[model samples]
Target: DAMVIQNPRYQVTQFGKPVTLSCSQTLNHNVMYWYQQKSSQAPKLLFHYYDKDFNNEADTPDNFQSRRPNTSFCFLDIRSPGLGDAAMYLCATSRTRDSIYEQYFGPGTRLTVT
Candidate 1:
């Protein structure tokens, strides 16, 4: 089955603290990405790894980072979460340039700032 998975479906973070969210995929996709979706708006790409080739979105905040150690695992690291960081963090995957831009998304990690 094609599926992307994100753990702890929800996360509560304190201001100025670091937090990390994890993602995994069973789809064996070559491209894996981390995105921040705030306030039901369009998902913003933070960064992604295409089979070890990392690409970061220019508009992504410096406070956000990501890594993909292997094909199946990826992570989103927040150096210091601000109040504005409270939002749904989505993990997505797609076959490398499969012609279709469609991506499979996980349930997402909803981060709450306290």
Candidate 2:
């Protein structure tokens, strides 16, 4: 079965600390998204990697960064995380840009900023 897996399902970091969450997929998808989901709220798109290209949401903070070294792996780096940054970090992948309807999401890494 095709799936996206996020490592370190739960992460805890001190305020102003840096953290990196990793997501790897067995689907070999071309488009990957890094999103943040707060309680009872929809996921907000932070950035995406389409093959080798990176696209960041206009409103996404500069503290958030993403890297996709290849089709199967993606990473999200939060520089100096604050308490407000605590949320579920999700990794989603679609086969193509037009196939947004068919995204496979990872279980997600729940981040906690102390």
Candidate 3:
């Protein structure tokens, strides 16, 4: 089925090391989003790309950066992995930014910091 794809479903990194997680979609959606979710906590929107325009949540930290090299792919770069950063990183896509369009999410990449 055409859907969002995330690689390396699980990742292990040492503290202070940089790690990158990737996402891709076959849905050909115009908007892509990245969310960080901790255990039992609601997912937080890190950033999104509306075509080539990047929209990052104001509260998102500098440690978290994203890149959408093209329409079909996006990458999340964690400048420095921290214990607090260990969580599920999810990638989603929507037809538009409109509320009426539902976002489809990827299975998610679970990060473990040593």
Candidate 4:
């Protein structure tokens, strides 16, 4: 069974507060990705964890970071969330880096920065 799960369907955080979003997959995929989507904008690829190697996008901000302690789990930590950070955080998994287009996405976590 291939499935991706994201905790806390909705979240609210104070401005400048740190928050974390988690994801896990039962598909045993080799690649896990984190995306950010704002209103009326397509999801932007923040980063990806692939087989013990972490890859960060060129434009990903320093305030955002990720940790993958193991293959099945990944976490996105926002060191100091700002109002601009309020958006839908998505987690996705793929069997291989080359098959990113075929990845399965989690329901997503909506973060509200107050």
Best TM-score among the predictions, by candidate number: 3
Please report, in order, the local distance difference test score of every candidate based on alpha carbons: 0.91, 0.92, 0.95, 0.94
Q: In candidate 3, which residue pairs clash?
A: none
State in Å the error of residue 43, model 3.
Answer: 0.9
Candidate 2, clashing residue pairs? none
Point out where model 4 deviates above 4 Å: 97-101
- Candidate 4 per-residue lDDT over residues 1-114, each given as its tens digit: 679999988999999999999999998899999999998899999999987899999999999999999999999999999999999999999886554559799999999999
Candidate 3: worst-modelled 10 consecutive residues by lDDT = 94-103
- Local lDDT at 10 for model 3: 100
Assess every candidate by TM-score. 0.93, 0.95, 0.95, 0.94
| Candidate 2 lDDT, 44-82, residue by residue in tens | 999998888999999999999988888899999999899
Weakest 10 consecutive residues, lDDT, candidate 1?
Answer: 94-103
Stretches of model 3 off by over 4 angstroms after superposition:
97-100
TM-score-based ranking, best first? Answer: 3, 2, 4, 1
Residue 40 Cα positional deviation in candidate 4, in Å, after optimal superposition: 2.3
Off by over 4 Å in 1: 97-100
lDDT at position 60, candidate 3: 93
lDDT of 3 by residue, 7-109 (tens): 8899999999999999999999999999999999999999999999999999998999999999999999999988999999999999864554899999999
lDDT of 3: 0.95
Alpha-carbon runs more than 4 Å astray in model 2: 97-101
